[model samples]
Target chain A: MIATRIIPRLDIKGPNLVKGIHLEGLRVLGKPEDFARYYYENGADELMFMDVVASLYERNSLQDIISRTAKELFIPLTVGGGIRNLDNIKSVLRAGADKVSINTAAIKNPDFIKKAASKFGSSTIVLAIEAIKQPDGKYFAYIDNGREYTGLEVVEWAKRGEELGAGEIVITSVDREGTGIGFDTELIKSVADAVSVPVIAHGGAGKLSDFEEVLKNDVSAVAISSILHYKAITQFQSQKDKLEEGNLEFLKSGKKYSKIEALTIQEIKTAIASKGILTRN
Target chain B: MTVNLKQVVIVDYELGNLFSVKHACNKVGLETILSFDKREIENASAIILPGVGAFGDAMDNLNKLDLAEPIKDFIATGKPFLGVCLGMQLLFEESEEFGAKKGLGIVPGVIKKFPKEFRNKKMRVPQIAWNQIEKPENVDWGTTALKGIKDKEFMYFIHSFYAQPIDRSDILTITNYNDFEYCSAIHNKNVSAMQFHPEKSGEIGLKIYDNFKNLIV
Candidate 1:
């Protein structure tokens, strides 16, 4: 059996790592490189750098950051957001990203998935679906960080992504994201069951049990941002002077987010392992 | 620490992560050159065939650049050659990916894909996760680059196809995914290859590179 991966998702806005509630009210955390290095040292299975505002900006600004991190860090680095055409994927991969996650582009032109997979190989292409739960209990795919609706059902889109040769699928729940409650396991389970590709559960990870809860739904990995970010802020002191982009108020204040528990990657993995779940030590 | 003058020649076929491999080598204090030049590859003290794309495209690039013979010649010199991921798969006779594509045939084997459904249980292809590498029974890792590495150590893997060496003696490590066991690494004299990306496996991965750097005579 493949060991379940514990990935720390770092949502990037401009140059700084940021966190928000329900993917809104964005707050700058610190330089992404600092957080990335910390997570690597602490045994994160993989690190995801998602440009949360890339779609709106119409370009990805992660090349410099990805290249810098890939120089010393030796692990799978996945970059998502604003990846549209083959050139965009190629450039990011050349910039040292192991995989490129596509959302808005894939949703607009479904064939983009096929083109990317064929060009860069399926293993290098990840289908990132941002899903927002509807009032009718169904999940709909959203774009631009849950600002635009694609009108495509989450489960069906996942199946199509698999058919188009996506090696993995990351299902992010907009409703439960950043709430510190838990993962939207129902949405995760629906998508996981609809496709054979490895599914990465993102959004709504607040505590150790939240990770455990999501892993039980046949998901291959869990991408935790808030829980890991909160833990990191308390442990490591960022170079505040170097960061000039994004909101630095919360980070400079040194006040912790009271809602979520800060837990290290190792601690979470240990907790999962105790539950008989296989994780890389 | 004395600076080792030896350099590893990482083949640049435009299909693999050459930068990370070179960076890892440099981190371990080994100089490296990312090149597809035939003469440069043949003359290097050590060679690393790092790849991460489809088998057909990799082979095509190798042929296009006329690197197929030089790589074989380098291995023939017994100067330490390491094949990573698709690079390891390219050493086989042929691969079943996108049809039967010919490989470098350095090692006698065929690259086969992981079954989509094994024993009625759906298996996730492209096994993109950290899986443990175990020394096969009667295989002592002390002789190979995996020396000093613990048994069942996890390594990052991202591939849908795996190698099946015709000679059992070449098999270095075995990894089981979804109850399917397959060869994860191979050792044939001076030629060594692994299915996992040692450069991307964290500190343990650096240890592997360190071992490889030491292997250079």
Candidate 2:
């Protein structure tokens, strides 16, 4: 049996790794390459880099970052944000990303998925769907980092994307993103049950149980952000106290955030494995 | 031969990301180059056919570049050669993906799509996930491209169709997705191809490339 993947998703703004509460109040965590190296060493199954400002800036500013990350980080890297066309896909691939995830462009030009899939193979193209629950207890797809609504239901859009040759669908919950709440199990289960391709449940992974909750569904993988980011900060904070007091000035000057003792990838995998689910040891 | 000058050529058929492949080779301390030039193809110490695109288009590119025959001829020389993902599928005789299309016929097999449903459960196609590879008993892969890797170790996979080698003896590994078992890696003479991407599969994945590096060395 295939083990479920535990992926660390990093949202990039400029060259810095940023995290936001509910995808807002963005705070720079650190350099992407540094964090990527940390995650790669710590047993992250894959890494996802999304340029949160790409669509707004209209340029993929993380190309160099990705290129650098790919050099040292040997795991699978999936890059998203502002991927507008085949050229954007080509450039990202050239940067050494294994897969390109598209959200807005996929909605604007449905044919873009087909074109990219036809050109780069469906496996290289991932359709990222940011879904929101409406008042009527339904899910609708949103794009542009959940700032715009597509008016298309999540299930229907996922089916369409798969039909258009998308190899996987990453269903992110707008309702739960960055909240550290938990995955929208109902939404993920429906989407996972709807598509014939693998569905990755992104957003709202606050604890090991959260991963287990979503993994119980048909999701092939889970994309996490805040929890892991917090964990890295916590780990770094422990080392800071061991350094000379004057050396702490460098850490303070770089970036500072309250740390949480979040679980490591191995711990999460162990937790899941304890539940009788197989995971890479 | 000078150190750090080994020529491991990645056959670029104008499909997929050769950068990661080259980076993996470089990480393993193997000098890598991406080219479709026939002379480079014939002269390389080893050849890697890495691809991610339609079968027809890949074959079309190889045919247009006049690399199809050279590839076979290069393989005929018995130097190490590897095919990845779509590159692996192209080694089979035919693929039913996007209609019936022919392959390079390097391996006696047919590429098949996973059934829509398996064992009363809805099976996901394209199987984009990390699955373990079960090694066959008869083959001694202790010194081959799969060296330093244990049986049933996980590898990242992203594909809808899998190759069905006609000779079971040629299969190097098998992976179970849903109720069915499919050939995950095939090894024949100087040629070996895998359905998964070693470049994208982390540490163990790097070991596979290192093993390949050892093979050519």
Candidate 3:
């Protein structure tokens, strides 16, 4: 049984995970490594460490924070921000990072995705598309934290991103981010329907039901940072046991081992061989 | 009844996606090694054969890397060999894509494409969407990953072709789109598989992987 994932995106400033409001005024929540492990331990499927300042920071912060997150954090970590050229990507990858995310730099030079794909392959490169839905219900691309408008249609840009070579697209509703209004499932369906690669639906996750609405589609993955950050929803609970008993397949498979009887990854195996889990469902 | 620790090595063929399975085992604190070495594969508690992408290329890569032999021998030992997607298809005798190429032949079937008629105009052939999962009534994953997601529940799927499994009992989970029920997972003593990318599926996905790792140990 393969699992769909829930990943937490941490915007890092230097060595710590920081959260900002509308791309301004920031506050330190916790260390990137600690928060990363916390999420992984708590039931986060994977992690995204956006070097929010990697592009803006005077120093790349490549070696220090990302390396720390990679070495200490464990679970797959995707690092992005200020990644302009291939050298930057190579530098971070060498530092134990699993994937590299690019935004402003990629928009400026579309060829970046192609080159990275050629080397690391499409699976390792995640293209972050920041979109703002206009008054007319059309989406226009926004860069630098929604300041500058690229005037590019969201769907067209997404297709080009896939053609240029990207493993996944994290299409975030800029207005919906951090609002807890629930994800824009319609927007996500359009983008996911338009491309073959994986799509990570971000922005506006108010509750588990919101997750249920988005999960209704076959997008690649879903990323919820604020909802998890604010403690709106708990990641993997005994829900699988309940789902299994409830006779629901989708709900049962994602039961994290962490939540199931405090077994290590290895013990989870032994537990299975012994038929410890009651087959009631 | 049970298996020992550190005896299994997940054969990393480097041709398809091994991250989800490998990462899941690692997360559950399982000490499984990821390798293409023959010695390691032959003497393991279990072997996870995971792959994605074109079948021809995958078989080509496995042959080029000289893994076909050891992989077959590994299955002969009957110590649990789990194939995912392309990896699962390789267990069959042959594949229909890019000409009739040979596969590992552990299972008795060939890989084929999906039928191109759908109730929804946009429901396309690749089966690329989250649909309901139909749990296998007979086979129970005792302490397994499928624990989280239940029947008629959804997981992510993205592929044009799929395996029409030779052994009906092997099919563990299926996803219903229109009139058809596509097999999403399979299990046959010492061998199991899932067409979906579980590692990428989030918490529920990890739970599934953790259960798979438990099977290995």
Q: Could you say which candidate leads in TM-score? A: 1
**Can you list each candidate's DockQ?**
0.80, 0.79, 0.06
User: Candidate 2 chain A: minimum summed lDDT over ten consecutive residues — where?
Assistant: A241-250
- Of all native A–B interface contacts, model 3 reproduces a fraction of 0.00
Clashing pairs in 2: none
Per-residue accuracy of model 2 over A160-247 as CA lDDT, tens digit each: 9999989988999988988877889999999998888888898788877787788788788899888888767655554444433222
Best by DockQ: 1
User: Would you list the rank order by DockQ, best first?
Assistant: 1, 2, 3
Order candidates by lDDT, high to low: 1, 2, 3
Better of 1 and 3 by DockQ: 1
Question: Residue B157 CA error for candidate 3 (Å)?
Answer: 5.7
* CAPRI quality band, candidate 2: medium
Model 3 C-alpha lDDT per residue in residues A103-195, reported as the tens digit of each score: 787788889889877666566688888888999999977777666799888899899988887877888888887666778887888898898
lDDT at B119, model 1: 87
